[model samples]
Target: MKISAAARFRRALLIGAAALASLAPLAPAQADGLPDPGFQIVQGQTALLVTDPQNDFLSPNGVAWGVVGKNVEANGTIGHIDQLFAAAKSSGMPVFISPHYYYPTDHGWRFEGALEALMHHIGMFDRKGQLTTEGFEGSGADWLAQYKHYINDGQTVVTSPHKVFGPETNDLVLQLRKRGISKVIIAGMSANLCTEAHMRELLEQGFEVMVVSDATAAAQLPGMDGYAAALANFRMIANHVADTGTVVGAIRANHHK
Candidate 1:
């Protein structure tokens, strides 16, 4: 069986092309218009991670309402976050909360970022003391009234407060890892800051993160649309981004009540 020189040359070229193709790096998601890399809601392995679900962020009378209220109402963020809480609890999925608090001592810091300075000036999430409930009941640092039931439940894990935007300063990752949570369905207040930061960090920590878009809102300044910014980042960074209804449906479908 003798092969022609031309045929052998063509075969060599094909083999070389295939080898090169195998070595080529795949195009990034954004470069290819971003295909959806979906995530599954496995009951025990996946948990709901909500950040800064507090009075200051969600309540109409709280300190940050001036900047965050409009976006919150428009997105129904408060309600959506509650829905996620309900779904997670009913489905027996773990729920982890990452709250934010600023004590009197935090105000004494030498320097702070723009938002941190503003937060201190405005006294957002200011508690009486770390260990005292004195002025904490109705304060900005307290949990939103409606969410208290879910959050206060003995089963939910509330990690120490994240002083800044992300969970880096908190024990959230430790809590999640201890519970065997490798996939996180994330939601909560001030989307552009805490929510996005959590998504980025958890992804870096080797967890599959899916963001619940409508369940979080952000401060929309005159020139800064934080919610819009957060949405863009969520699409680019998270394994998937979905609405509250869609996420709740997934949770219910995947786990029995």
Candidate 2:
């Protein structure tokens, strides 16, 4: 007996639905996981520019210290940063270092109110101790001395951009563009505030951005999960969120080319 026309139509519809269901998983994956952006690798077309990886920002002795201060020093982000610097030097890729330094406050009561005031009130800030016209000096200067091997080895090019924010200072964006750098690898201290701001600006400017997860830190604010939140926001806006290992692999991959 021949099947009825209605039954054949129903069978076709069911098969079509089943096929669609089978493809549903792939649909989201395809939509979400596009091939790594062109800037994923450190070679050929991208530059590895670390933001404010200075003694003050990355070291406990720095004014804007973070929970990762000791960890960053111990885990060799300092050394890894140096290695990246060396790679850039060898490849002639521009390695920009945005160190944080401030001129002496010629005027007294420069920063009287706001968060600085609160930090001071809570003994978080000090004038002669933490705030001074010191750069690559004092105990904070130790890391720079240790990492000087990379500088002396001709493995790194360093530039200090003094601004309230790293990405905004010293025509950094312009310089990067001039060097034909379309992708920026960002890592540094206070991930939630400065790093987050930089990532937003970079994304807005249409440059592919990658935040090295392991190389950044956040303040241990009370009841504030600033670091994790910053990472989440960065992951959403950035071209990719990679750890130091992935970043290293990408850089090495570029070297082979």
Candidate 3:
């Protein structure tokens, strides 16, 4: 039987695809020799660190909502963070919020990065001024209404806003060190940006950091999946990356024990 050239080409393509598929694992563990140094929540020594839990990153009307809202909803980030807050408060564990804010003076910077420029252009986390709370209520820089109860409680340590992605320029390290917090459970908005940055800096500062996998989300652009990227980094870099339910369970179990 004489086979047609086009039919032969099709057969070759199918064979190539099948060969490629066969080369791939049915279920890759993705942890090729990676070690997960698990974290244990301890009273007084462990704290909850939430980054950028403000309207700009967590609210529907935020400027960056169009880019990040999908992931936020998919991960149930808002409710998860609320749960962490409640757990921390009930457990008598300290809660630290590393907020992100940009005052009017910040806009006059001579140079900025890509996201910085975009954030400035879009007015994300823009506040009236540092000295006054005027027009701050319900603004992008303001805390999400639901989180206000937890954050404004006299106990929660709200650090100065981190202007950039990380806590390098902020007093987060000082606050943590002063409180003798050696372990931190981190969660919050825009997973790849502020949340991940906080994790990295805290780890560098000698804090055993565990990132809440679903309690944080990120912007998903056409070619970029910020959430996926952040997830990969969290698994590879943090002491442990667990889902909200697991983390919440651990917190409750630790406190109840």
Candidate 4:
């Protein structure tokens, strides 16, 4: 009953698509005062925040696997994001994957005691330029490959942000601002932590934020409640809370306007 990596990815994507379809009907065909991509002078003004969809968070064998609970992994949400990517491509909106990249000697390794000990044991953070020893090209690299096909489509623009905190990337903020992006659609791993951080920061920076409920995950620990709780918390701060389909529908409707 073991699932292969490819199979897991496929399953997650399918689940996400199904979720998106269900929400399509609920979204309005048009909403007044909302920024519509169709009339917007700039193309790719809308940015899709694909946060930390890494193998370590998505793969069962990753270091934080059981600690954050099984739901934090990407296996369940990859497919949903794929559907969003399709919508973004059709709308000419820009997709950004905020990957968590760390060097062997990076200071990020010293944050959490457990993670540091594990990295030391695995020699991933060694000063001698040793790579991760957990196999399959490690989490970050593996996630990049898993989504390589999407990138090849030339619709999504990926960025590697090297910050321990989700909202700490100045480069990302600057890029979005430079592009005149006033709103952002977010989806990614560890909903309560990284996802929340990003949403808060984006809102604080004066960008309207939409959080895709089913497209994000949270720590798998008890009382986490996975997507449900994450969605509720996001609803409080974000401009809108919707599933992948609803967001895609909004984007499409706006694009066609």
TM-score of each: 0.88, 0.67, 0.87, 0.67
List, residue by residue over 30-145, the lDDT tens digit for candidate 3: 45655566788888899999999999888999888999999999989999999999988988889999988889999999899999999999998888898999999999999999
User: Where does model 1 exceed 4 Å of error?
Assistant: 1-32
- Global lDDT of each model? 0.90, 0.61, 0.90, 0.66
- What TM-score, to 2 decimals, does candidate 4 have? 0.67
Per-residue C-alpha lDDT of model 1 across residues 102-201, encoded as one tens digit per residue:
8888989999889999999999889878888898887889899999999998999999999988889999999999989999999997899999999999
Once model 1 is optimally superposed onto the true structure by TM-score, how far is the C-alpha of residue 127 displaced, in angstroms? 0.9
Residue pairs with colliding backbones in model 3 are 191-217
In model 3, which runs have C-alpha deviations exceeding 4 angstroms? 1-32
Model 4: how far residue 254 lies from native, Å? 2.7
lDDT of 2 at 48: 73
Residue lDDT tens for model 4, 53-100: 676666665555565435543435667777787777778887777766
User: Which one wins on TM-score?
Assistant: 1
- In candidate 4, which residue pairs get closer than 3 Å at backbone N, Cα or C atoms, i.e. clash? 12-79, 13-79, 16-80, 58-74, 68-220, 69-220, 191-217
- Candidate 1 local lDDT, residue 198: 92
Cα lDDT for residue 51, model 3?
A: 92
